[model samples]
Target: MGLISEVLLLPLAPVRGSAWAIRQALREAERLYYDPAAVRTELARLEEQLEAGEITEEEFDQREDELLDRLEEALRRRGATGEGTAL
Candidate 1:
């Protein structure tokens, strides 16, 4: 049965492979986006930019809020998944 199914589905191999690749890419992207260390690094860079006058206070506030939110979400996700305590 397995051999017969594989033979029948051989024509769809390319589609299946593409779908798998897409899924893997998405997973990797999500991992990086939700990484706590990466979020913190971005936050630090944002602070540096503010201190250097590269960004206005308003802009800094807005971007800082977004980064904090991402950090909160990452921690929450880690807690939910029992990945250990927050950093």
Candidate 2:
């Protein structure tokens, strides 16, 4: 099964995180959605967690999806920045 598909086989997961990591990941993910390197890093981490049974595949998938979605939104936001407009 795929990552998302495998995630669907499990019950809802509960995760705990530091506020710092959450904010940092969110910021990084915005520009990193389609970046293969970023995706690979996250995927490797998720895969390791799953392999260790620290997190289920479903949890990994959900997190991955969230990151991707955030990235897409970020790109849209970035695109909306018109030419040479100072923020």
Candidate 3:
């Protein structure tokens, strides 16, 4: 950008910096969310929660299905990227 444009945008620098930080945080969050190990840990936690009566059967079933789907997707991603051992 030209000097004039940079000067004009100086006032918004903080806002732009905040937006960049948020995007970075989201990227990291998604990476962890799709990690195979993280998914497995979540699955175990969900099972434990169900056994503890912390969640109803319907809720458990729904969450379990979602987690299983994530697991499958994570495995597929691992195979495509060669980042982790496929399940």
* lDDT to native, each model: 0.93, 0.65, 0.91
Residue range 19-79, candidate 2, lDDT tens digits: 5678889988655664545655776787788889999778989987876775555455656
lDDT measured at residue 59 in model 2 versus the true structure, 0 to 100:
93
Residue-level lDDT tens digits of model 1 in 1-87? 599999999999999999999999999998899899999999999999999999999999999999999999889888999998646
Ranking by TM-score: 1, 3, 2
Among all windows of ten consecutive residues in candidate 1, which has the lowest summed lDDT?
A: 78-87
- C-alpha lDDT (0 to 100) for residue 3 of candidate 1: 96
Root-mean-square deviation (CA) per prediction = 1.3, 19.1, 2.5
TM-score of each: 0.90, 0.39, 0.71
Steric overlap count per candidate: 0, 1, 0
Which number leads on lDDT? 1
The better candidate by lDDT, 1 or 2, is 1
As for candidate 1, its clashing pairs are none
